[model samples]
Target: MSNISQLCVILGDQLSADISSLKMANKQECLVLLAELQDEASYVKHHKKKIVLVLSAMRHFAQTLQAQGWQVRYVTLDDPQNTHNFTDEVARAVAEVKVDEVLVTQAGEYRLQQQIDSWQSSLGCTVRCLQDDRFFASIDDFAHWADGRKQLRMEYFYRTMRQKHNILMEAEHPVGGQWNYDHDNRKPPDKSVPIPPPLRFAPDQITSEVISLVASRFADHFGDIDPFFMAVTSEQAEQVLQHFITERLVNFGQYQDAMLTDEPFMFHAHIGFYLNCGLLSPVEAVRQAERAYMEAGAPLNAVEGFIRQILGWREYVRGLYWYHMPDYKSLNFLSATHDLPAFFWNGNTDMHCLSQSIGQTQKYAYAHHIQRLMVIGNFALLTGLSPEQVNEWYLIVYADAYEWVELPNVSGMVLYADGGIMASKPYAAGGSYIDRMSDYCRSCRYKVKLKTGDDACPFNYLYWYFLDKNSELLANNPRMGMMYRTWAKMSDDRKYEIRNSANKFLRNMS
Candidate 1:
């Protein structure tokens, strides 16, 4: 048997050079095992671009590790003898090379964590699950902060994180005398100003090979596989981040919540695709934005809003995901049971908003946050789509989606599936909200101004229908009192018309 002291298993998502498992390992004594598993790629029919990104990044990371003198046993999915799962691969690797222990960073999802937990017994070797230190806060740290809290709100948790990390801080006080500038960041789409497209990298040889592999292997998956230009290396990812800081950060916050037809990137930083995969570090991205602000390169509203996304919302959601797991995924507070519509997959709907958002997703496997939350997710909330269905769709369609981030954002923040754990109320909205935020209504077949009848926007009646249906569960929520009072004030005939319009639309959709 070959003499190896440890077998460090690096997952596709754990591609960072400084991940915990690699840090604790001696380059000479450790055999770094990076595998492209079939089971992982097909877990939920991930978008073609997502598969390409992960596999390509993994291959590039392996090259980097090897160049740094680390011994790596890379497993390609096409290997005839490959076992196609983590447990079997680890077992095979250990049997081939005698190792004293196996080291792995804690998984980002509950399902994978359960499998990781069973490895010690199955492999008959000591298994060390290292905490993922890539984040600003540890899982245990989040747990400690969560204990004894009556309400787990992100704003309070965010303030503490800002203080702990000293991001945008002026000696214990937040910079500009404010902790949040979300109010200044919600301007509707400015049609006059030109939007700078996110920088795209030409597929290098490594990524081109991954693209061909995904195209053939995952031919049936969602999204287009060709024209895949995302950064697959840490250096490339950093370039993308720098591009955003220079060309896009000034306009990012203002148009962040706005949507426009055929404009997918919209001045928003697309680095989440890199950051989620460990090719880019969250803290580094936040620091760069803060630097830009200090240098007067970007406004405080833009800088703070961008920082809040990474340092606040991204970290907050990850904390919430781990703090409440296995049980958290099953929470469906509204009892939403409708199936995800077929149009979500093909973007064949007549609603221009959904068609635009989903069509963009189909081509690029991405949508801006507002397109995700207000347009698509809001429709799911109003129409009572199954949380399971919506969650899977969100996971499948987005390149940045991992269960840790996707679950809380979809089930908690978007669908209100976790009751009030992550959101004060369901992110429900009427057609007018979409109309005000986007130019989609001008082209939609349905009338945004109409509240009832065949041509009325489905969101209009469905919003009230959702509120009326879930009144028993949500009527007492202090934040929802205004909506409830408005519903109560509606004449019985008006309410009937809304319910009828909603039921009719839902039946047709079904």
Candidate 2:
């Protein structure tokens, strides 16, 4: 009955201790392979913090496996025997240690999916790429939910999830008697409200070593590489989640769309990386936030809004990824084509809003939700870069830029490049929104309200220019009809001036 005939692959992101593969290990029979592949890091010149977090977590997980009496063939990026790639290293391990099958939880990426799926023939063994099963839903499970639906909506899917998991519910309904509490969550953060600082973890030696390696290897990559500190382990992830629910979840929804001065992380749970890398489960994160609300009568807006994001929006994004990818990544209904400005790479810019947003991106690789959606995404939308280019940039720039989730958020939700498939209409805007939400406008030399002038806000001119340029496509769309009507009232000469000013801004940027 010696069943030690299978090989289990433990990827860097697959550090979850409760993963079925670990519990399924036969101790003496199966070997878990964790390889540090060069291709993974260099694929996009990923952020330094992302590189350090994964490598450090992998080492710790390998030790956890070893302590549990499972054989772990841990290979470093610089290992002499390293094949320098994931599949090559996995194939090498499989051949050197004979196995009947290779078991794995699926990778949350398109590039790796093709690699893993094809390796079965090369290894001359069955490759059982099982579902990651870490999410509240899986690709298969989500597909099942999508079956026969005329159109998909996260609200409906999320309600199904709530019922299926019996979370935040009373008998058959959501506890608040309605499926949503969106109304309460829209209030901006009050100056009188005292918010707590984010939970921080000291960079242990393991993490510090990874940082050193990243610094040495990727000295020329875009974005900041310094002062990297956040969750790197499951314990750290849990502690961060705990702090979020107890101290911040109550206000998370209210200020979810609000922006504040000098606060990047803010009430936002910087736990996306943890959830993305498998340190935390989405359901647990949502459930805990819900629990905090019930126990403390936390504002319904705050609780409901936070719950909807994780249980509804995050899951919806994942399902959309599986439902449409490869093709989804290529959809550019708007047909936008321009270069992302040089200012995006470094924080060097005179436009205060752009400078501040880019500066935060350099410092922490994070921008609050509004800053991302209305400012960065809005700017990109108006300037009109090809969807693929903008998608690639977003995928590489953020801490949470895994293609599975980031693509739709960028090309579809952000750029409106997928037309109306992923969004009802464009999230178009002018600069006044940014002015209202941030202090950047005050410091900015450009005039936020000016549509055309030597120093008019490029955002204002570009905003009108984008709408006018795309009026043929957007004018009839119900979501934007009102705006288009307003546009129709504007003089033709004003439209000419806005486009002219926007052109100058782009010319100057280059």
- lDDT for predicted candidate 1 compared with the true structure: 0.92
Angstrom error of the Cα, residue 309, model 2: value is: 1.4
The TM-score of predicted model 1 comes to 0.98
| Position 375, candidate 1: lDDT | 95
Which residue runs does candidate 1 get wrong by more than 4 Å? 1-3
Candidate 1 per-residue lDDT over residues 1-510, each given as its tens digit: 265789999988899999999999977789999999999999899999999999999999999999998899999989998999878898999988979899999998889899999998988889999999999999988999999998889999899999999999999999999999989888889899889877888998999888888999999999998678899999999999999999989998887798999999998889888889899999899999999999865899999999999988999999999999989999998899999888999999999999999999999999999999999999999999999999999999999999999999999989999999999888999999999988999999999999998999989999999999999999999999999999999999999999999999899889
Top TM-score prediction, candidate number: 1
